[model samples]
Target chain A: MATVAGHPETPLIEPVDRGEGLGHSIVRALSHAPLTILLAFIGVMWLVPTLGLFFTSLLPASVISSEGWWTIFSTPSNATLENYRNIFSDEAITSALLTTVWISIGSTILPIIVAALAAYAFAWMDFPGRDWLFIGVIAMIVVPIQMALIPIFSLYDRVHLFDTLAGLILFHTAFGLPLAIFLLRNFFVGIPGELLEAARIDGASEIRIFTRLILPLSWPAIASLAIFQFLWTWNDLIVALSLARSTQPITVAIFTQLRQFGANIEIIAPAAFLSLTIPLVVFFAFQRYFVQGLLAGSVK
Target chain B: MTDSSITAEPPNQGAPPTADEAGADPGRRRRFLVALGFLAPALVFLGVWIVYPTVYTVVRSFYDRSGDAFVGLDNYGTLFTTDILLTAIRNNAIWVLVVPAVVTAIGLVFGVLTERIRWSVAFKTAVFMPMAISMFAAGVIWHIMYTQDPSQGTINAAVRVVSDAVNPPGVLSGAAPSGDDLRGSAAQGYRLQGELKAGEVAHLGLTRIPASEVKDGVQAVVPATVEGGITGVVWRDFKPGGGGTAGEVEDGEVGIPGVTLRLTDASGAEVATATSGADGVFTFPDVGDASYRLGIASETFRESYGGVSWLGPRLITPAIIIAYIWVWAGFAMVVIAAGLAAIPRDVLEAARTDGATEWQVFRRVTAPLLAPVLSVVFITMIINVLKVFDIVLSVAPPSVQDDANVIALAMWRTSFGGVNDFGLGSAIAVFLFLLVIPVLLLNVRRFRREA
Candidate 1:
């Protein structure tokens, strides 16, 4: 037995050797049983409400009205894929799904592109009033979307962008740029100055250096930024709700169903689940980068 | 000229160049141009979408609803005076007061507790899953959870089960007085029309209860005479085919069990209380042979234990705040967990080795170390909750939306949601911006210090 004798007074037990049998592991686990149980209990509290909603979505309208969704545990045969099938077949839901995809992609890509260029400028290239300009972007990060709604509503009306997907995407992109630039600039600043200096010494133009040296090196930051922007845009309701009426995203579409006294819950359930699925998939797939971006974006 | 000067510079860039040799003015101008080229698109966006509109909204706030006439301070006056907007401000105050502190506390607990557990990964994944979903989906989830009907709502169903287990509902929930002998309504407790003395037998009749609702093992019977007290037979008065005499308990009718009868004096002060047994016979024994009114307790006839109206006007703000916490607590936890991971473990071990208990170590060592991260989470949540629009719109029914309204929702409602008053909306928008200025300054100062 490898006796790990570092801190005898520590309440939490240390991990035993890998070669130790399952019995040892079980004993170690049981040593911290109270904390483990508490964590598991909290975790279940967080997950049960979502699980309940998910089970409710699989139930039929009549069954939903007659009994609690927990009853499905006793009668597992009551579950069906009918709600999913119905929502997929509905024109409004399908179109909103398509709109959400388009908006998310446009909103994500445009901000990353614009913010990357600007971040490069702020980080490496020297310009007049550069610090002040970057601070201005930082300040706008806290400007409430409410501040922009009235004036921009009028602007969109004049420019004929009202109720268009392009208009909504533009709005998301603009609000997204401040944080994107801030995060990417912080990351871009950390890249070795010698690399950019060497490229400049090689007679590479600014655009050439930006494309070949800067962007290739900043993919981690860009990846994280992309995921954050995509999630934000996909989950947005205020921007889409204000700017785009005819081209409503899945969020707004589901919101419409909710407004009708929770009518057509069969539709709202599956549609909300469907709307949530894409972001979840993207999030889990790139969770590492997403967390990295979040930590870097928030803390100094 | 600046473009040409960049090409004219010597290739000896690594060696420190003198001021004249560095192409001082033109090279500087060229660098400025190149930086401008890179920054142009972002600057244009920031100006148009944020800067221009922010300034315009401030100016528009001073104007009238149509934005033509200059009605300085009137819209601001209306914001402080209007009932709906005032409610919105109050609700926003409630949100700011409650949400950030609760979220930070929960996050700190989750982050610290999961550090030593093997199942920490799975627990965190479960908690953080809500952050990935849109607020609309969360609203939908909570909307169903908060439904008034126990059968349809999971929360209500759970509440009903617990309440029913603790204190069961009475059998007279839907039962009402059948004859003219009972005189009061359910809001006021029902009473006998005439006073009764000890040893008198009062016949109490109830109707409108379904047969299926009556509890098992209860049987209707005539009350036996009891000494020194009023005796009553509370029974279902209606017969199945309506052939029984009015106000009389027939063979088919059953006893209404669990009905509480109150004995009150002529001055309406309650003297004694007694509950009916399985045979519907209730006796208020030990009465002092004084004349008293025989009455039914209002609680006996009250509605069955339905769950709370979580989304009603009184609870809507708190209910929506809970929903907001559900979505954002994971974000806070993830961030705080990262901060927790960054804390040096030796300090904790050292404290433990120095005879500090776990609670003392946590209170003195851990909490101070986690303060910066906690403040970051708190500030971020304050900003997030200040602009809470979507969850309010999605979860609250339209009838009570005004009751649950916040400042951002008020801004949207005033400008876009049918009211179309641009000036007041602009005033609200500016007020919201002003509210965020302090937090924004704090964040900027932190960033500047870090840079």
Candidate 2:
């Protein structure tokens, strides 16, 4: 009945009849026909636009200009892979795709590592002003990235990190930390204290306990954080738009093409489709953690 | 360590701690240092990227454009006064008022509806697919859909088809009457100046007919007089290269087909109507023997309906908002769906068993239960909307970019899009920060309570 995987104790809707005959089941199904139709209608409305764009991307540019995308159904032979081929072959597009990959990886991994360590300290270790420090970091979550842009722009310019991939990655990692730490620390605090105490009695150092015990135990939280951070960096445009001039990501690349070419669908459609495909693949692959992370981050 | 402490000191004598006690202080200090070490990297990042920049921006907002001179509150004053910036603020207000509410409502409906359907998984996946894509890609998709050309734009094509079926457009929309015989405006029907009897013939000529609009097999022919009614010919009077006499049907000139002629008496009441034939010859055979004025129907000369200008200045902000909703509604749905799944089923079953109608259950029980999730969606959307940049940049045409600007886009433009006014840009940025603070506080408070 489409229950949340994380909350298996509660189903969205209880089934009215579990052991009913076929006729009774049929009647129950018939009663929900209106709702089924409404949901189907909404589903179609959501799918058609993306489907139209996908079909448009497949068709030859000449056909796209002369006929509506819906016409692809009647004449499916007109579709081609030339647009995708062209974009893949283009140097700018390939470079941008590479940039996006490396940036996402760097941004995702750097923040996870840093935040995991900080989260471990906040959760287990006793330090002076630890609670206050954690709260201070959490409060920084509200600072809009706009609040950082001008100064960082100047900072990057002075440090020669302005248009570099590293600069973008660093910016993403820094911004990604607050929520990452919050999520991971919350998860870390749930672990039993005896596990760490036993390891400490066996003479495990703080670093060893962190690397061996805490990191291994908190995989679920870390996985979700990883996926969340990866998607954030992957889909980001504004930060890349502002800071990275030469080392542009796919989002920035597509945006620039849209502005410069002005609805040059052949270049834009395939490139944009490719840009979104990676995240969709990742999202579906790790769909469980994605949802878990979403709920953990927000519905607390 | 406890045994050493117990054995080294007598319980009755309140003496100073033994050597082991003194050693424990350094151990505690070492643990503190170790914790600091673990936190050091993140602390550096937070301080450098977020903390330092936030302070710098607030301070920079008070300085002049060059940053050398201190100009207190001047940039903030200019932000309120400037037309472009004000438009940005207005658009942002519109966005905040519209996007979060609409998106959340759609999300709520989808979330609830999917629960009743068997193929709920497929429905959710379809709706939630857009969330995986970047806003730039979504913007491009909608931008293509909103193109001005009907053949290219899916939306305009659909609109044109529906509108055309409901009220067919005029064929000779831009055609104008030639000579002094027609004596009325384009909005009102053009009427022949002279009165005509049943047997009389009238020749109406039109100019400015586009060559592309003239249909094939339309030939200019002189109307044959019928027995009881007047006859007329409406044709393209001016031939190519301008050789034809005005108000006359010349050879090689095409007929203005589909022109509806209204026959009105001296009292201005319509008597009969006739549409011109393919050859531009129209005859009203049933008109009585009376003086009448032959007028072309105004509907015949009205402009054909093109689809709406979706990216025009008037609709650009709304158009962009629609795209924003398309990209974000899925997120709201997924979050709310999670919230829905977390709701206990027995409460709903109990409410249903008590004879509560579905609407009542939804309005009274379900909605209140989903309030926290809904607010989560709403506030998240508000924060996202305030920072909206990519969709606006991609979807809005350059000519109307200013018309669709929000504060985030305005800030980017002021600082980086060749303006280089960092001081003013910082002020806008800080102003955005100020606007976000209350929402931020609410979120933090919620997080704290939950923790």
Clashes of each: 0, 0
Tell me how far the alpha carbon of residue B181 in candidate 1 is from the true structure, in angstroms, after superposition: 7.8
lDDT over C-alpha atoms for residue B86 of model 1: 99
Which tens-of-lDDT digit does each residue in B228-319 have in candidate 2? 88998988887887777887787888887888899999999999999987788899996887899898998787665567899999999989
For residue B69, what is the lDDT in candidate 1? Answer: 100
DockQ scores of the candidates:
0.33, 0.36
Clashing pairs in 2: none
- Scored by lDDT, model 1 comes in at 0.81
Question: Candidate 2 docking category?
Answer: acceptable
For all candidates in order, the CA lDDT equals 0.81, 0.82
Which portions of model 2 miss their true places by more than 4 Å? A1-34, A59-68, A71-78, A261-265, B1-23, B176-257, B276-285
With candidate 2 superimposed using the best TM-score fit, by how many Å does residue A44's alpha carbon deviate from the native?
A: 2.3
Distance from true position, residue B315, model 2, in Å?
A: 2.0
